[model samples]
Target: MKTLFSLFIALLFSMVAMAKDTDTRYYEMRIYYCHPGKLPDLLTRFRNHTTKIFERHGMTNVGYWVPVDNKDNALYYVLSYPSKEARDASWKAFGSDPEWKTVATESEKNGKIVAKVVSVFMNLTDFSPAVKAQAKNPERVFELRTYTAAPDKLNDLLSRFRNHTFKLFKKHGMTNVAYWTTIEKDGAQPKLVYILAHKSEEAGKASFEAFRKDMKWVKARDESEKNGKLTEKVESMYMTPTDFSTIK
Candidate 1:
């Protein structure tokens, strides 16, 4: 019996090791700014073809969304890869796929679908909750927030989020989706980007108001800024998941 128990313990350890090996994933956030009056065409292409092609090349589709306000004619999506090396290879293959080439050429026969493409590579922060595609609540409203840190203050900003802000956010009924720092190779600014899920737009506003008024948060923000402000500006957008979005 002791020997059997010992074997079971070794097997458990092996399984744990394997799980850890596969836990580190890299993500890419892509914003495709479609040409005026061509937003539907861009979304159609992804819904009908691009996402399948991505899966064929081993990319995991995390989510796809369109901003509720629609001010920029943009589509936002996230893709996950097993590793940075895997991401690079997958993209190279995806771009070279014959089906993709045909689809892109046909989609652009009238006019170019996209005006600009902004891509950011990101690694999940230590404190980020695991985001599962199947677990997302369809009724939840997702808020994407980007914070541009003041020069040389990116670390301070991260520290605040890691140590204080996230906790306060939860206390006020915010659901942390995921957090990431832009990859250096992507030439992204010194910024922190994260998504939060709220029960509704009204709930989102109420949560922020409560969070801002919390004494702990007020104290933390004041103390952190004693040296200098950590962020220069913050951009926020509320998004709704598309019908085919994996997360929604």
Candidate 2:
């Protein structure tokens, strides 16, 4: 009886050690811009084979999307891995897999599908909600935004969002999806990226307008800017989730 009890305790410790915190997970945001008329090929490949192959190699498919307007020649998707090292290993295995090699060769028989690929690895911030699929209540439109921090003000910007901005956004009818900081490497400035869900494009605009004018928001913004500006530039893109996207 004593030995059995000791073994149970050791097993519990092993289980605890194996459980990884969600914050330690590494996520990849990849955008693939297709050749002139090859977007269909790329989409078909991902839908039929690529996503499954990624899973076989231990990568998590978060969501996929495309722009809602013209020049919709790009695919945006995110994948999660246990860690940065795990991500590298999975990609290496995926690239060399026999099935993937065959699929890539057959798919490009028409022509090279993708013209450019942009990939950034990121980690979710401390105060951000966990990344998961949300129900499509009334079919929300998602806005992807990126901010380039001014000088040394990234932490200040993150703090403001953690404490005030996201809350006001919710109060005005915007759902904060996820927030992340791009893992800087080789002298890259780590950018802040996030997504907000809205009922519609017009609704998102109205919510932002109201949020900006609210007295509490105005005071918070003024106080944060006393030292200096938080960000030098902000970029935004509105997107609708692809039919296969788990988030939808």
Candidate 3:
């Protein structure tokens, strides 16, 4: 009996350790729309100074990219934090850093570099692979997909991805970078956003073709929508890493 109790205690401790290791981390996805002809200045700031300042405040610079197919001058990047509290604290510190203030002041001496900024705070889904699990292929293309769920069907959409869609994606050779749902106050509630990596644009096309034809995925998607469609619309964009990006 004593031996059995010892084994139970050991198992409990093991579970606790695993839970701690897998603690949820928060992510911030920021999109910057550059002022006319100012994209270079914005990129220079991030490459030479902003990224280092972010690190000083405990923010993990995940990756930075510019859309391959976007006509507008836009930049997208991801940052990781241990928790929402940590994210808030770090941003507060980063905003107040004298160096950052100096950089911003000097960089925009002529005019503002950015015309608009959009930020979304996200929490990773339960099944998302770690950020470090990204593929090492330098030419890999990252596809960011944003889905707007039908009213009241957000949970249903998340369930389908959690249980069926992600597995099928992996089976078709797609690398799941990260999955996230925006925090409510960010304004786009009932939305699912995720990034996938592919060897190339042609590979991405082929993978999605196979993924859509997968019988399991078809059945799962159909069944989930019997009551009503899960997603109303999906927006997708292909992005390539900037030369100075941390992840590529």
Candidate 4:
């Protein structure tokens, strides 16, 4: 009986260790505009108002982007936290804050700032190795990718990329990851947005080499490509989170 109990404790420890290996916190937002041409105005407002509102409430801005080239017309951003509870509570308070309400209302006087928005919550999978203890600090090198897919191909593309490639990435030390797709809505083009965290630009450059060489990812990507058109187009950008000066 003692031996059996020892085995059970050992198994539990293994599971806990594996969980820590991939533990990461991520938050995603999709900001859909009333018109594509209005992006410049909206971005200015976001930089001036929205980011400050979030910071006051405890959210750490991870990265932000506008569509440089893509079918989807939206401004997507990512934020990170120590846990989901904090994310939920912070947003809840921010939403009700008088300051945020006033700013959001005032920003749209010229025109509608956002026609719609979507929020998604996710955690990194168990295979991802932890980032160095230091990368947990607020400032780090990161990039955001928004891969827009045709409605018909959305599910298949998600299954391949999210379930397959993402898992493989975690095993290769791509930790503290965040990924999500926009909720289906009229005029809303579906997109998969994810943030990649790295210690430096050089680290980001080198880390992907491992993922690129993964045999399973290569085969799966090729298979998806051959099966049919999985993506109409992909829009990706490398961006750093805004600093105090940029936000100001």
TM-score of each: 0.85, 0.89, 0.90, 0.50
- List model 4 lDDT by residue over 1-39, tens digit each: 999999999999998986676545654454454465666
Give the TM-score (vs. native) of candidate 4. 0.50
lDDT of 3 by residue, 79-112 (tens): 9999988999999999999999999999999999
| Model 2: residues with Cα > 4 Å off, grouped in runs | 1-22, 70-72
In angstroms, the error of model 3 at 198 is: 0.7
Each prediction's number of clashing residue pairs:
0, 0, 0, 1
Estimate every model's Cα lDDT from 0 to 1: 0.90, 0.89, 0.89, 0.64
How does residue 204 of candidate 3 score in lDDT? Answer: 96
Residue pairs clashing, model 3? none
Candidate 4 lDDT for residue 214: 85
State each model's C-alpha RMSD to the native. 4.2, 5.5, 2.2, 7.2
Q: Please say which candidate is ahead in TM-score: 2 or 4.
A: 2
TM-score for candidate 2: 0.89
Which portions of model 1 show Cα errors greater than 4 Å? 1-23, 185-189
Instruction: Candidate 4: list runs displaced more than 4 Å.
Output: 1-26, 34-36, 70-73, 81-86, 128-248
